[model samples]
Target: MLRGQAKGMATLFGQMLPAESSQGAEKAVQWAEVAGRLQSIWTEFQVEQLSKASGEKSHYTDPVKWIATFEAVMRQLPLSNPQVQQGLWDEVIAVLTAVLGQYGMGPRAFEEAKGDPHMPLRDRRFADPEWRSKPIFAVLHQLYLLLSTQVMKHAEAIEDLEPGRKAQLIFAAKTIVDALSPANFPLTNPVALAKANETGGESLIRGFEHMLDDLRKGQLTHTNPAAFKLGENIAVTPGKVVHETDLFQIIQYTPTTDKVLATPLVIFPPWINRFYILDLNAKKSFVRWAVEQGLTVFMVSWKSADASMADLLWDDYIQAQIDAIDHVRERLKVPAVHTIGYCVAGTTLAATLAVLARKGEADKVASATFFTAQVDFEGAGDLKVFVDDQQIETIGQLSPEGYVDGRYLAATFNILRGNDLIWNYVEKNYLKGEEYPAFDLLHWNGDVTNLPARWHRDYLRDLYRDNRLVVADSLSACGVPIDLHRITTPAYVQAGREDHIAPPSSVWKFTHYLSGPQTFLLAGSGHIAGVVNPPSSGKYQYWTNDESPDTLEEFVAGAKEHPGSWWPHWVEWIRALGSDEVSARGKRRPGGRGDKVIEDAPGRYVMTR
Candidate 1:
């Protein structure tokens, strides 16, 4: 079956290239017509499917079947029609001409112009001794990039299909190009070639051994465990588990200051990973910094979900947050507590606040801060492509033992940045025979956690598919309807400028829902890096607009750029929101008012796997 599919794809491509004699303008016109015909074919297929199911439920809700149907119809598209083929042929000739011109220039021209910013071929691999000195290799690299660019252009030209389907097509085209990059193979990649020549091919032998070792372990080896140990070098924040439940443990870090704020800060880190991401190490730990700044910090460390916890629902998670918040309030003996939620936890926090508001008890949350979390899903970015009626159904089927495996969730996220998180590791560990580095952030990234199947399914259905979170009283949790607009707690919203998982634009939508004084911040870097940014690094800058513009674009346009991390700015914002300075209070011991110590700082839940 696979062989036949490969042959069919090859035949389709073969028919997509026109003869050399084809005219350019005429071919362009024909290509446009062919694109129109493909759209018509897609429309016809949809009509026929609808007609066949006139009196019955549609099978379009079954994503696996819907995808198969889409592929079948797409295969019938006249992509290889005469005019389209001619246009493709013209693109080919143009690339060929460019490649020949570069080849004729012969190595010397390239070497002299190597560092020029305007150079067409900017890839460093093309400048290596194995390729830069060889014209053929140089031309091959250029041709690959040129062809990939043209292919992507064609993919983008495809329209009239559903948004998800269109994105899938474009993604598939890009994946093909990425897979065929010259750096993946030993013969084409200069670095790999140099390694082969250096150790007499011993690197390849070692790489093969590493691959077998990973296979035996049934997982990709992302880090060398020997390089770093948990609770010693990493996750070493000094604290005690002041409270525990079946779902989560609250860790109260030992205070580093003599005077701490009266209002204790409670953090709800996303349960998708270990809570240690906020407390990775001394230098990078946000928890430590917050403590040093004279604040009592309590972190909710969630237990890793397994088969035993498969029946856990969304209400259960929300209740866990309430339980943690109540515990912090009771221990601190404060009327209200400041709250911080990261990613999915932020979403849950918003919902929890709404639930509290419905009961007229929302004043318990003095203020709220959301990091890389989205309350509105309309512009949720590329991750939305995977959240549809059919896709949700397929995911539901994959949840064995009532839980979505953490490895599967991790793999999905890796695909969002395939080059950095997936291919880079493949090249370094499998092709280059390099050992994984002892990076604290990378270690936290590799520590995956599972999600309850019911919770995962409901989240996608209610938030992404239905988009009920934005509508007042449309979403209900724990028998209480959630109206985001009803919660008037002061909010601090931060989004990463380059975040793909949760785009800055989506995060900006929080401005529309909140009724209190709100501050929006845009930080540089991706999701994790942007949120974990510390001031001492002096690496990335952040943007802020005092006006709080009505739209994301307006805020971005009027925002002032600030050097250094956003941490200090955040501290000031919290202080302004009634976290006043008080006499220093050292870290509260584990046992107080029926609150018993479960374990040490890192706790059992974080060390579960």
Candidate 2:
């Protein structure tokens, strides 16, 4: 079946090839016509193929089914309400008027209309010169923009719609609008047609091959996967595993200086992903930078969850953190360790600190640092859209292995920024047959870890849905009630200004609960880039305010913006917190002079897919 599909696609490409003797403007028009014909044939072929595979009409392959689903969803909206119906009608009329007016004006008007108010001037998809220069493509683009705008306005205008339903409706409407963009189709996309012409139809042939490969992989290729390797080009920090457990391994890094801080720093990365994000490369590595600052750094590399680990709960993860802290304290003979957590680990770290305070073990962790982690879920960004009761109940059925696959989490995160993360790659990789650049961070993003089903369930219910972690004695971890208010450990909370997973507003809510002195910093980018901004890169800036204001706005009002990475400021803050020096541990022996070493840095556990 696959061979036949490949041959059929090749035969179609053969029909698209231009005679070598033909050249100039005439050839371009001919190629555009060829692309239009291919688009029609491709649609029919796709529908037939999907129908055969499913043994029934496929939802995606059938345009009628897609329209039906969209209509059904829209029908549930309050369109019957007189006010809503009137508002929608007005919006549709306005859209039609704009589109028809533009169509009547024709190509010469579009050239001048580039500066028009309704033009999607900043939108990247229409950046190709042909979209503006060509009449048909320009009109199609304007029509799509006008109609999609009306659909969204209608979705948002639904009177008295519940917030969750409203968000879902807006998202669904957006998904449909984005999917149906004229630029996504070869016939309408001048760039794709030009490439097909330039390659003599070879680009389209390769595009089909790319699509088949992606289908086999069951995910879109965002970056060249062959470009990166763990512990080589990425995650290449020098360290060794000091201890190993069924759940995680502790990696103690090789120090760079003659002396180190007396208090060792242990980092607990989110189990939902590989710990290597902090150690992407020598230049970007937060781990290497800390080691260069003469700090004894240890990282918790979590094991990828499988069916055997599915029974693990919130308490289990919390206990594992405590156990790691204790092991570091006992092995290094230190009274305390500085701790840092990113994303989910940071939330768990807040819980761990509360549990420690409740158990009189708060002194075990001297200082806590959070990177884009939210303890309080109120106003927690778009991720909240997926946390309603219906979705939470279906978490278990997501995987038969009794664990949520890492890919599922990755895809959900991608959906939040679908145009950039999902559709952009689809157009580039499959439609254009182009390989994306070698981005170390994106490569690391693709390497994700599964979540234990029980842990995920408890986390969503107790923290996200119930908002229990903030209230004293309301949430319990490891059989002990944990409260953020009891945590007296000095904290450095860093949030990304553009973070969707953990909104900075929600992150700043730490001020409302923590019974400790806090310094809040806001970085200039989204989740990963914001947190991973290293001093060496001199990239995005970060804002800081010593005054932990009650509101995020007040905090921003009083905040001073710095022009580079926040790492040096954080390192300085770490030093200010009593930086007594100790002789640096021998590098040959990772943990210490006599401590047992499990394996090299990054460890076997983090290397797991």
Candidate 3:
């Protein structure tokens, strides 16, 4: 059955290159040679591996269920209108006809035939010159484009479906298409085949070894993990832990400037990852930058939780932040401290702010800044696909121990950018047998952290699914009925324009809920790079407007585009909040350590895993 199906597919593919003309005949012969080599190498590896197996049969040739699964799911959704089905069928036939028309053409004619209106966007996966220069590869690329785009296009065309279902369908279809790309398979990947030939099949052997290693490790290798160390290289900023709790440790960074702002800054990074993401290196570190800018910086390093920590709830997380806030205030001898939170930490901080406001202690935080944080999940984008009730329950069941496994969370985020984070590594490490360059960002990304089961479930349900953070009294934190409107503290909201995890529209909704002086800045790039972007690199730009417009589109329309990182702009805004400069702390200790110092920066809590 498998061989017959494979032969049928090969025949259909062969017809897409004419056999009559001499030029077509030449290209067809080249394709056959390539196919023969690929088949030999694949069969050799499979047989060799199968011989050593435990006698359990493997289903390598099973037909792909991506599109079939999509069809099944869509049939159950509200996309069954006859017009929608007809529209999808008409598009599929039109694309198929256009694609098949290039069969009998010569090289130049085939190249020009790409001018058909249905040609997909320039996909970087097939960017190699050989994809166009070689006829078979070009045909494979074009046909793959037709199938993938049609799947996604039909998914988007079901306008009658609910917004949530539509978004889920589009994301699911895209993921399926991305996984089924010809570029992922050695037999279909032109680059992998050429590399195999060049190396006399050694690349395939090395790739097999690499695949085995990744299987043992239980994750794809995106970077050389050994290339970086926490204290020695990546998170090498100078600081000392001032306070510790079961939930978190507070690291007080020694200031770089002689004088520091009177109001110290406390940063609460997402517990899903280490705080070192903000202190990646001296150059890229936002914490280091803030310290150098004459500000006292304290970072909250969240402990990597296990099943023992599973019973912790959203209120517990909020209380932990509250504890950190109070500790920073008392240690610095200040009435209030400026605060910043990234991602989930920012969401919790917003709740803490509401809780503080309800308790009539709003002034404890001098100013608040959010990095790619969303309080409103109403168009939260692809991340929402993982948040429906059934999946949440499944996640709980998977985590019998009390905390959601960090690897599982890592996998969830990886699925969001499958083409980049998942398949790219699969191609490089497992197909090409090449190692990715050492990158601090990828290193930090791979260093995942567990979430307390109760906290994780409540977060997804309350903030993501129910979206109670923005609604008055709909959500509560620290036993206080939470109303984001009561957060009258001065606020600085920054969101990445291209962020997928936290969409700008949802982040912009932070402005709507906060009854405070507000500044909404839109940074370039996705979530991490945008937030960690520093001034010296002089990379992507940011947008700003004098007024926080009601709609994200309106804000974009009236905003001024400024070049380079938004770091300097943020510093200026926070400085204008009017805090005096004071002599830097820790004059007595060797490393400028404060009296309550526990350990060095990038604390032991971060090194847990």
Candidate 4:
């Protein structure tokens, strides 16, 4: 009871505080045409093929027969919802056309469903038990039957009534018929699926199923933003309101306090997501691993922005990096330090390196490493396809205050794996009445954060949209010119072959674009798995090629033997720079302007998530 009262008070206090401004120098549109062309083309091609193979005159011409065929298939397959069922029917219908397109649709139209546009929706119906057990293909044919008949009737009605009312009446009829329709497959208990409809439809029901699964699997969280929150530790404290930028800094670790290393390694992670992803937890944390290896590691953890920070642009982040570097150098009494970055954060690092190099301060940056980070995005795989004008518009409209909600960003990721995360949640939480896991990673993932909208918007536009990094016209943190070729820092790039998000092909382009003594290592795992990988358990492998112009093709050519877990290899490479002699203690204060020590391994940020 006491805790609850305190929690409520804390919540109330937090609500009263003002938030940082969102990114405002950008648009708000979300691109819908991303990674959708494949399915779209496939749909068109399949229809033509099916028609040709079925010996039908044309697929669209014989809507009844196709509907019948779909119904037959639905009876055989267990489809989850009407949306899935509808999509299935659409595919089968395309197949019919593809197979039977040799005959002309104009002349060989189905007699029963002639000119009927609304027939399908008006007549479709199915029983719950039987529908759930039905085969996918059988349901398709059944839907085809219902849809064809309705379409035919709608066409007939169109000739008698006015065009506007006729369309409305048809839509109303379709809606009614759709209301009675069961999912192509019967969902035993929706699992995470919705208990009550928000709008309506089988799509919603199926979504519930997916939601359930995601919740149970630790993909989604039910709580508020905690992932990037700071705690009461000097090493994890936000810089005293006096420093340049208030980014939380980590200066010291207790585990390796006895053997302080010479090199200071600070990691700059993307503000697109929370920083804990890199330092997730002990045993699974890369940051923790490095700290154990005796490297003086410091990390910049972004705080969720509020309404007052809308004008913060990408340049602000680069300056933050520079300020962080300056702060760390001042505190550690070191002339320069090693820096590592992941994904978009790496892009910022590259810009920082360029900025520092142009002024002849390149030597201050001892070494640099990019983990699956893309600088040259000429062929940035399909991920870039989504960064269109509309998406920018969406970004503009939604982030009016210039802050991009981390939950919204996470939502986009979940969209890519909708069946596993989003739908699974609906299935479990709302349908099956199951619970989410107590795992830290999932809990952290649920801990939301937001970016200053202007910064994120500029980032997407300049980097993803304009491909500024690839073109070498990237603006520096201080509005000065940047040259990618100026990057002479010893660099190591770690990436995964099967990374759907950052394809090796796209990531390796950094070598071609940047002039640095670089080694590109390709790991054999998906994006998340490859990074968090432990040794000897999985078949993780890597290959490297220090070739020129670092294209995917060039790297593939020089590839040779497979190396085991890359973590050890990285330690060896960086170890060569360290001295075996006893190192001196840090003379300067930390970036946070304090010299206090932290108790926790992952510190406050990890705990926040």
Cα lDDT tens digits, model 3, 277-391, are 8988889989888988888888899999976787898898899988899988887678998999899999989999999999999999999999999888888878998888977
Scored by lDDT, model 3 comes in at: 0.79
- Which run of 10 residues does model 4 get worst, by summed lDDT? 25-34
lDDT tens readout by residue for model 4, 35-87: 13223433554575565534323222355754664454333333545775687
CA deviation > 4 Å runs, candidate 2:
1-69, 76-122, 586-593
lDDT of 4 at 126: 27
lDDT of 2 at 245: 93
Clashing pairs in 1: 258-584, 259-584
Shift of residue 102 alpha carbon in model 3, Å: 6.9
Where in model 1 is the C-alpha error above 4 Å? Answer: 1-79, 100-110, 113-121, 124-129, 133-136, 187-190, 579-595
State TM-scores per candidate: 0.84, 0.87, 0.84, 0.62
Better of 1 and 4 by lDDT: 1
Error of 3 at 507 (Å): 1.1
In model 4, the runs with Cα more than 4 Å from the true position are 1-244, 255-257, 536-539, 546-550, 561-564, 578-581, 584-609
The lDDT of model 1 is 0.75
lDDT of 2 by residue, 98-169 (tens): 645664687677557656553432366777776755556766786677667767877888768788777777
Q: What local lDDT does model 1 show for residue 609?
A: 61
In candidate 4, how many Å is residue 450 off? 0.8
Candidate 2 at residue 327, lDDT? 92
